[model samples]
Target chain A: MQLFRGLSGFSLTPTDAEGRVQADLLGRLLQRIQAAGVDSLGLLGSTGGYAYLALAERQRAVRAAVEAVGGQMPIIVGVGALRTDEALALARDARKAGADGLLLAPVSYTPLTQEEAFQHIAAVAEAGELPLCIYNNPGTTKFIFGEDLIARLALVPNIAAIKMPLPADGDFAGELARLRARTPDGFAIGYSGDWGAAEALLAGGDAWYSVVAGLLPVPALKLLRAAQAGDAAEVRRLDAAFQPLWHLFREFGSFRVMYVIAELLGLCQLEPPRPILPLAGEVRPRVEAALQGL
Target chain B: MQLFRGLSGFSLTPTDAEGRVQADLLGRLLQRIQAAGVDSLGLLGSTGGYAYLALAERQRAVRAAVEAVGGQMPIIVGVGALRTDEALALARDARKAGADGLLLAPVSYTPLTQEEAFQHIAAVAEAGELPLCIYNNPGTTKFIFGEDLIARLALVPNIAAIKMPLPADGDFAGELARLRARTPDGFAIGYSGDWGAAEALLAGGDAWYSVVAGLLPVPALKLLRAAQAGDAAEVRRLDAAFQPLWHLFREFGSFRVMYVIAELLGLCQLEPPRPILPLAGEVRPRVEAALQGL
Candidate 1:
């Protein structure tokens, strides 16, 4: 199976006031994103607060997402953990829950070497028959996958694609070129920095792992459609309109700001997990202004 | 209780091949460190692989340390976790297991705001009667406690000393002076960068949170004793002697190298928890050379 390509929308795991996963609400949100023309549905992505959720809660989330999407689009479940055994267990559970593919990050409290990381992904891939997409967000994982490591990991069976963060130095075109040359064929390369989605898509990246798409799917789909059609002018026009929201994402992290935006749009009525409160103070006003502009 | 003051040795949590905590081995190791005259014992520290271990394993390690020490010295237990409720549970368990104090790090998969972190720590402190030491290891925790936040947290009742990493730029004296001026009286400040410990001690820092002290306690204690006596010449002499081990630490990280060194000395037979493998290949020779020099 083609694990993921084109525009993949990450769905937020809506929770009740007591911090339990509200699967019915989550299913509704997934239906909304799927209706907006996302190529795939990514549940329990970083935006979904997968790391913060317990194992049972995460399994429930996958079940709800699969039930909601109903095979209309591929459901990719995030199955990353701090240990190999835990990640393997999650991968098997995700497969059993009817997830189409698994998305994993090197979730760690301690730093991981390239060899250790390779072994970890290999073990998880072997645990289930589902394809896997490697999520490389160094900001959260604190472990960057260099071209050599990515190429090495691509050789492992069932390791299908990679979702990479935009280069901090703003060299998206160069980094994308390097990744294309380094990774083997049949391996899709995607970009996840929402602010750089347009540039990355224009540079021939396979997918935009979008946060905004989960909340405001219509606009996000429009931008992706423009990029896919090679209409640079239209892509720029839409990107310019989304600049205010992107600015908010840059100031406060996308994870926090995405919650506020979702709440404002009435897409979901749940708060972000603890230790990750919503935007407030000076940033809150700016987020409101950005949403109004959107 | 005063919690900790001069040299505090962080004990390693030894595990069997199946990754079960070997309490008997851990207890024996604690006894050796105490015999070396450490002022306090730190169980389940970063060196102790606290984040990698489950709650029950951590509790068992603490129980063993307390039993081994038998009130010979204070045993501070690390009780940090990704969730506030988990941290609170650990704090309460540590107290029940006869730990003298609690050590908390703002362990988060999602980044935490100052207000959220303050609330988390405050909740943990309120859950238990033991004193709390704020651990600020940005390398692992990824959240540094700025002066303003530290000052605010210091005001929280039962929040005692801070175990800080020496500044990466090697400005221990400058950072120590700033922390001293900002925090309130009686809030002891400790330093944890093993290489720069001598400089921090000379700067009038309250404690040395030593990783090496857990294994090679006599040498670690001698260096601390020299610094305490204001014997700059002896301190530098010992620092020079430990240079090889410090070099290994800089290259392969202290956590990985320390595990190898411990295994080499037969202090513990277990490897580091998953995602953090023991050192090998080209680095193994260098680590061996460093240990032989010691």
Candidate 2:
């Protein structure tokens, strides 16, 4: 119940100088995250290293994260694909990799009906005994999940949480009212309100999927710890420093934004695979300036 | 070669009493389409059936169609999926199922760059020796085949045609011009321009997909044959009678409108599967009245 309760950094894809999955680098990254003392780690998520990797590559990423964390923290692995069978396969692999749970987003490419969406979640739930967290990133999938669908998914036994990409204007208040009313208090509700994390956390959310937590975990964790303690002053102060990084995610595309920020801060240096163009060259200077300014 | 010429009917999916794939009914539908003397048969496309059928169901639909036509006509199957490997697998299966050719839509779900789109087409083309027609239905897939992408696809070996869904506005005209400049004259270029079949045929397309042909093949083929003969008078007369069907397709939902017309005319009695809810019950009578009036 309420398994995740702090800033959960969606980890990046770890790569060596040769641009392959660098297990050592991943282990180091996990150690760094544990040092920052974030509540949890989100591996192979959209922000984490998932879509960019092949199934084997993704498996390595998940396995490395689990082994590196060594029970120091819980890890939520992203399970997304086009086929129900493939998504299910990934869920099983993640479970085998010792992930604490899965973050299941609807398969990409085909638009799913409410019934299909419900069936997809059920399939993933049955594939693994691990607790499942439904991911709602409509911007990437082009398929928005209605409240009715979410309510239906809440009934699936293994579904323990929902990590929703909050809409800009009505992120927390509207969804929180509906989800809190339908879902039991035991279920983790993560607000991927992205930039609006501090306000949303204050407004009430069990955890957050934070891009900032990947590089600046101490500040991100401090903000969440303060929010949990009802320290608005601390939350506000951290949010201001963190606001610039959030702004970068908004200005650039989603997949490559974090990697660019990572390269700038010397936290990690890895290029996204082809088909995902890098963040603009100009944005790099601004990211450096923002990190320094903070 | 010009595999599909003149008007082709995108056949409807047929389900049995228990609401499973009814091969017998599908066979009948294809037989009727062939007996009706339309130029080609489009099976397993968006209009042929729902978008999210399982791989087995898709293969069954294709087999049923091919068996029913029994080589009496050209059967073009649509093989579209999100994964490169899955789509290629479908292409190979379609070839074995004895389909005359393949019409591929870009993989659904993920946002694709132009290079990914080109690679998808090339991969499918390489999968089988059968002639391939790239289906451009941006309305459904949220992918627009830009001029450069189309030009690159034009050079893809075994890609024999383009099945473009023409927008209501003349937006496809520029792309058509660009394709015309890049492709040789004998290359087949068809339109899934349901409402504007006559106009598109007049505009130099080798063939067109027709939902209208399913219910009123006599009228649809009359219009096509007349247009082919340059008999403007006969073409206008048939178009006038058929204008009600075209207007219905344009004014309301085409899938529902066409299915209702098919049911009313006793072509395929089974209704669309769930989530693709039918036209309102009250609208059915009006559709009936319009069909009778036409």
Candidate 3:
């Protein structure tokens, strides 16, 4: 069965005070997310701080999520790295750890050509044996997969989906339509920018690879359900309610803000890894207010 | 002694047909550039394909250059990586391999905050006793060190210079003046973007970290020497002569064009690492014509 559809909650990698992954905490968080009716779990996604953790810690997190879910929900692991060999190694590790699919982003210090990107995903797909979802978040990765490239990569047998960031101009409907026209049949297209998930899903995007869903799955699911049922009014209400949190995300990146939200909600007690500082100062009251509203 | 002044040639990592680093070829290339009167040798700079090579291979290349140069010219090694710990490791290895200085770029797959960038460089500076030159090529690194961040990083004890990309608008004089006013004295400001090297050097930049210099060192140094001697007429004349090559660099990236030039000159026989296709097809005759003119 395919691993991605509807809401795939991107789980946070909980860590102890010394910044080591706390597998038990991760397991518990996944359990809570599953209980809230989220469709799938995506471990080590950007919101999960996958880029910041070591290989062993990432492997531990993936293993913990798979154990916690116990096949009740599909587990997709983010397996992205700067080097193709490293990404291949991580893909293999994720598959061995029982992940249902791989979320691959073209990570680079030097810019990669479309040919390089295609070959990278093709290699990982050949190596991992699991379905792959190309994660295109150029805001962070600096590698944009244009429609032509996505169409080309879709020819690979194992590349089942793409999780894309919403265009900066907020043209969700137009962008979704363009992608649908370009991509082949059975190739699922999902939206990742949490703020745009409801509109994108309502406008016929296949899934929402969501950050908010990981921490507040019940509400996130409710919003997704509203979109699925074509209740545009309800979707609008939920999107409005989420505006405060979205504001925080727009100001200081979703990764850092998500850590603050998880800690604020008492879902996890881990600081974001070093180099990523915690949310502080004037933004704290606003975040607290948003959490209270939620 | 300072490893950078005038033209610091960004040497290519000569590789065999199988894509393995040919250390002997790399050594000979460095020697030829030294003979051309390049002020210093910058091995493993982006032009060297440092990002593409494995750690041991990078180490071997650095050691080979050090041995070949044999105190004939100072050697600066590029020690940049995705992770902070990995970068620190590479910096230490470069120092151990007898590199005279380190060229550090803030490499990231996930975008880094200014705080993270500063900390990464600070940690490397603490670990690697060799003098460090910050390499600010935002086009590739996806991490820009603004004037404020550059000022703060300059305060780090061992950061001696910066290799800055020429501004996109080609306002070399204006950018150089701005940097000179902000950074402290004794901080050598070098310019990359081979197209702008003559103007950058003439506008008070202390060095030119040049890709063209690595392959066509004789002519590159003549341009630099003219700029250094304040011969504006000669500088303009040389830059005019180099216009055709600059046009190719503008179309494709410097890394790819430089590979074509090096191969055309009979200095090396290596393709630009895979994913970076060699210059061919419609660009071939144009490149051939340019080489002939040079």
TM-score, prediction 3: 0.91
Clashing pairs in 1: none
Ranked by lDDT, the better of candidates 1 and 3 is 1
Name the lDDT of candidate 1. Answer: 0.85
Candidate 2's residue-wise lDDT over B1-294, tens digit each? 236678877877776533358888889878888898888888877776535466788899888888889589888888886556667888999999999888888754436667778887888888967888888887667788886787778778898888877755765556566678988665677787566776677666778777767656777788888888988777777777766666777666576677788788777666555434466688888788778756
Each prediction's DockQ against the real complex: 0.63, 0.16, 0.41
TM-score for all models, in order of appearance: 0.95, 0.69, 0.91
lDDT string for model 2 (A1-294, tens) is: 235666888777776423357877888877788788787888877765465455677788888888899588888888886556667788899888888888888754435666767877888888978888888877666668888888888888998888877755755777787788988768878877467888889878888888677767877788889999999998899888867767776766556677787787676767665434466688888778767756
Give the clashing residue pairs of candidate 3, or none: none
What share of the reference contacts is kept in model 1?
Answer: 0.62
For residue B161, model 2's alpha carbon misses the true position, in angstroms, by: 2.4
Model 1 residue B45 CA deviation (Å) reads 1.1
Q: Pick the candidate with the highest TM-score.
A: 1
Give the poorly placed runs of model 1, Cα more than 4 Å off: A17-19, A281-289, A292-294, B281-289
Model 2 docking tier (incorrect/acceptable/medium/high): incorrect
True contacts kept of 2: 0.11
Q: Pick the candidate with the highest DockQ.
A: 1
